[model samples]
Target chain A: MEQIIDKYRGDSTAMIAILHDLNAAFRYLPREALEIVSDRLSVPLSYLYSAATFYRSFDLEPCGEHEIQVCLGTACHVRGSERILDALSRRLGIKPGETTADGKFTLKRVNCLGACALGPLVSIDQKHHGHLTIHQAERLLEAYKDEHD
Target chain B: MMIEVKINGKPAEVPAGTTILAAARSCGVNIPTLCHHEALEPFGACRLCLVAIDDAGRQSIVAACNYPLEHSGLVVETGTSAVWQARKMSLKLLLARCPGVKVLQDLAREWAVDTKDLLLTEDRGEECILCGRCVRVCREVIGKSAISFAFRGVERRVSAPFDQEPDACLGCTACAFVCPTGAVKVIEQNGRRLIAPWHSNLEQVACKECGRAVAPLKMLAHLRGLAGEENEQAGEGVFCSRCRRLKTAAAVTALPEVKFPGPFMIP
Candidate 1:
């Protein structure tokens, strides 16, 4: 954490970048870590929390080992991405934005991935899997689950 | 430099960069506003102060609080039908969101806005019209970015850090003092002050002279820090405003008198 703050030279303007680094390191912003950032940067905790919550990328809670983000953007929605998301949710036994009880997979509904051509897109562990059907998505989840086993 | 503008057919001269709202008010023209406060910057959140501006024949509707007068001889119509319709729509929307807020209700009554046709959502029984007054006051005036608007769109709300008790709140109640809808509630009881909206409960400091609750100890300390080291002794004693004034008066009266020459007589 000190290294992250040191990386930004504790500049207050690099707050978002610092938070991004912290998120990448810890997968979510821990309260203690945020407090350290606040103290080191001389920025208020409320302001940090506000920024953390405002951005869709930052996670406040501990995320799962595998993150599955389903695009719900205009093009993806028209191509029936909600059905894929619903299938994934049912199979994972967790709603969108929730991690599985085993902490293996976190299902997230994202607005866009900026790859509109790849309608009904899903990304797993930062790897985009586009033009998917429900069966293929479930199979992909099963593969990740098998890897966990 | 002063600029001349006509508001509702009445000529008014105001300083350059003065907002249409301020200029109209100086000339005895009333433009209704909700989110505007004299001390803070214009937020234009409520859209209640909408007015029609005819700038050299180009017509535009603007919120008067933040719209500065950039040019002279601009014609502003505060009571035009278009302005009235815009204000009425804004009121209707505000009423739908905060059905129980008396200020909105009164405005609706005066504007003859009928709530019968409003597409009502599930009433959250909320009075906070999201005017951003409390949030702005705490950030801009108090200089403690202790609380802020979190989330976006329908989920947006003024909240402390993680919705927990704000660690940096001074318990000054400045947020409550500036809130138009009485949404930010501050209650003092059992030697503690509770700022309800932010879930901040702070121990109140008692005055040294009369033992009255002065303010939150943290707030006094913050003020003392702001006052600097030279005024440390002055800031050490926790005295309410009334007691401080009385003490100053007593100190002034106890000063030694000195003889001086008579005014206009050198002898």
Candidate 2:
């Protein structure tokens, strides 16, 4: 596979931009891919590690295939959002930012999605679900239960 | 072969696969860190370790710990004003809730953050630093997802799967140690809850007056509820409801006591 170095072509100005795009797209810059870029452009490994670790958007770990992001925003508190989150935590048997024992689900929490209307929202992948009571959430999570697949 | 990065407009030779954070560390450039720990994998959830990367053709803040060195020639800026402000503000917000913990206060002092805005908004309850390290360690290292992150945003916490007290926790302090905020405190209270992961442990503090062991707080209230002014006068420290009622009745009524012994009578 070709390294993502063609985009940079020794142009340090363009190199950072390309890496950012790759990371934003994948949420984690592939280690091999990064090595290829570093080799082609002659950038130091220390710099790359530094850049990766210093930023908030990058992830050295693989992104969760199925992301369960709970909103812990301020408005969500007044709405008893903790109950919804707690219920999800129970049903999944994993806390936020953790994948299940089976590796099928990865739970995480975000501060705010700016979706105050959907206080206490839990989004699976890209699908957003909100306004969850424990009862409501149990029904919603039935989709993840074991099935004869 | 090595890659070249422009540091403050100077091209520098570096080894392959170096993140900006790693590079800065090697170069003795101090990039402030709060959530990033050397002993653990990169968890970008903190948002404090932001560095400007000239990637995607524009500069945006990305966590250096997780963002990789996928390019050779990138413009990176650390310790910028915007980055410091974001970290300071985040620390302030975290400190406002968990003032009981001293680490947050120390961090605030180190950063010289004296903001009244963070003080303006305070919420009651346990403070969770939201580092995700404890939650991650509890699962990844300990193999028991005994305690995990609950809630979202600032309201988030590292807790049992259901916030019902872990029915599976081995009473291990793994989660507690990695926790930047001491939000999750595990006391060796005996088996009282519906379910606990570990062996049943509970404390039964009884009523101080009746010697009846109830919950410690419950005993205090019960003693208060039964305490009468007469009990205060006699100074035996209040009695239970049954004893208090009997004492009050004994005091109110002129009891017909068939005296057995009197100092004034000769046997």
Candidate 3:
């Protein structure tokens, strides 16, 4: 933690990247890391969380090893993404924001993954499945349904 | 004029077309605003992203994303006293008639907008933050001016040719995707039922008589394609409320008027 502070000593401008780095390294940013970040960079903790929550990329919750992110963004919305998302949700037996009861899969909805060309995109643990149909989205989830269990 | 920006007090070269919003964010200064999205054009409508720049010239409240930078030996306060007050009030006004949204809830919490004791205003039924992200993305990115901002001031909203259905949209969910709230929807039939994520609850159809799940939209749409009823729709969802009442009256009126004061108590 002291090293984290020393790396950004008086260089308050490197706060966003520093927080991002901490988040990447620790998965979800630990509260202690945030406290250290606040104390060292001289930013309020509330302000930091506020900043983190503003952007759609950051996550405060613990993610499962096999993370499943559905593109509930609008372009996909018009392209029959609900069926795909519903299939994914039903196959996983979980809602959009919950990890499976088994903890092997975590499902979440991102505003847009910026892959509009591939309407109804789903990323399973960072591996993006593009141009997903309800058939395709379900097939992808079907593979994961038992792998973790 | 090249502006000298001490990002966290370390000087960096910033030229013109630099909105104060982009400059501060690049320098580890985080100013949160609702209407600011990198994918769309700058909508300075939401005044939450204000930054204070103290220089030799006239200093004032500037929207970072829209305000251009000039040659000035400057001191920029990312969260100054005046900036915070103005931002908080702007947030409150925006939330006054908030559509009771979770995304807005998260943003509201971050900007420290008061939740308690603040009066709630009428909802637009559509939770369009008026960010213009949808309109800009559709026009600029999608290159379809099928939808544009209609009306002005607080009454402004993104609408189709005449707020009917989008003639310009390719049935693409671009606007729906960019919408901060789930208002616009694209519906399609899967087997017999209607499925779309634009609404929280799905329009389900049960038998008007037996209460059995009878995919009404599909049944009606299919029946509507028939010869004489080319317009006469079938299924429970097709008939207008009053039309159905009149038709039911005409059908059952000739029969014995069955009247029973009924509360069936299961024993």
- What does candidate 1's lDDT look like per residue over B76-170, in tens digits? 99998999999999998888888888998888888898788865555777888888998888889998889998887788889998999998898
Q: Which stretches of candidate 1 lie over 4 Å from their true place?
A: B1-4, B208-211, B229-267
What lDDT does candidate 2 reach at residue A41? 63
Error of 2 at B212 (Å): 29
Compared with the true structure, all predictions reach lDDT values of: 0.90, 0.62, 0.66
Model 1, backbone clash pairs (residues 3+ apart or across chains), number: 0
DockQ of 3: 0.01
A5-31: candidate 3 lDDT, tens digit per residue: 577674678877777777666666676
Question: What is the number of backbone collisions in each predicted candidate, taken in the order shown?
Answer: 0, 60, 3
Residues B1-267 of candidate 2 have per-residue lDDT tens digits of: 587776545566678777677777776677766677766777887666777777547788778778767668787777778877877776676677666567777877888998566666555655666777866775677555555554444445455533344434544455556666665555533423222322223334433457543333322343444574332333235355666677789787866767766477655
The CA lDDT at A112 in model 1 is 95
- lDDT for B167 in candidate 1 is 83
Looking at model 1, the pairs that clash are none
Error of 2 at A149 (Å): 39
Residue B126 error, candidate 2, Å = 2.8
